[model samples]
Target: MSHDRRRALARHDKDGADRDSGGDSGPDRVEERFLRPFAVAAGDPDGSGPGPGPETLDLLTLVVAARTPGRSEWLRPEREAILRHALRARTVVELAAEVNLPVGQVRAIAGRMIEDGSLQRCGPSRPLARKDILHAVLVGLRSL
Candidate 1:
């Protein structure tokens, strides 16, 4: 975390710590109301520049943890919460709901997680078409 982000989180943490005992307490888990619009994104906390690779993420895509996050670098609270829920395969949309963050913000975070190799994306499973089913059976009867 940057100095500014650490200060912001500390200020928010101090303000929030006394009043909200039920909520999780952490730098990354700062309540949405306390965060500036751009601060909600994990990659670019200061929001001075755009973060990388949000292009690959969509709400329907599923993500799962590739491995445990690194203690030194990956300890941000928002990401930790996201990883906890993603221990099982889940869609980006589901992660958003579980984390209590907006879908767009969650998408950005998930995109970074995928980029960093902390999370892996799963392609959406679709039902096979009738023609696809027939194609599989027809291969056994083909004539030379």
Candidate 2:
């Protein structure tokens, strides 16, 4: 990767880490840490920029949604929009704005998702969430 690309992605990763430490404390940032590097390496195949391949983006999106703050519901268009666009959403307020929803509603959903196995808490201070499905796979491997 070009130095400029590396730097940009590093910046993105740093930003992601910051978001991981914020509210909602859900699944988004955990997945970003692993996938963003791959996305950067893949480059904009269409010559657009640092975006990853469509498959990768979709995988990461699913992982992000699965790990989302609550419900583990099907990927709603609004939630997908937030993941596709916003990179620094820690609170329901930020997520609501990203997905154009009422903060109360988002908060409820986030809480539900976290309660379900769809998301796992990272730490008390850190607001990171790991997609349970993906995490299960990792756990399975670690056991082997």
Best by TM-score: 1
* Model 2, total clashes: 4
- Please report how far candidate 1 places residue 39 from its true position, in Å: 1.9
User: How many times do residue backbones clash in model 1?
Assistant: 0
lDDT of 1 by residue, 27-132 (tens): 3455555733536655545343563445567778889988765573354777888888899899999999998888777887788878778899976477578898
How many steric overlaps are in each model, in order?
0, 4
Q: How does each model score on TM-score?
A: 0.54, 0.29
Candidate 2 local lDDT, residue 132: 65
Q: In candidate 2, what are the lDDT values of residues 1-144, reduced to their tens digit?
A: 476875675587766445444645535656555522332221112333423323212111222333433332234444344444333324446665666665444444444333434432222344346686578779999999
Error of 1 at 92 (Å): 0.3
lDDT of each: 0.72, 0.42
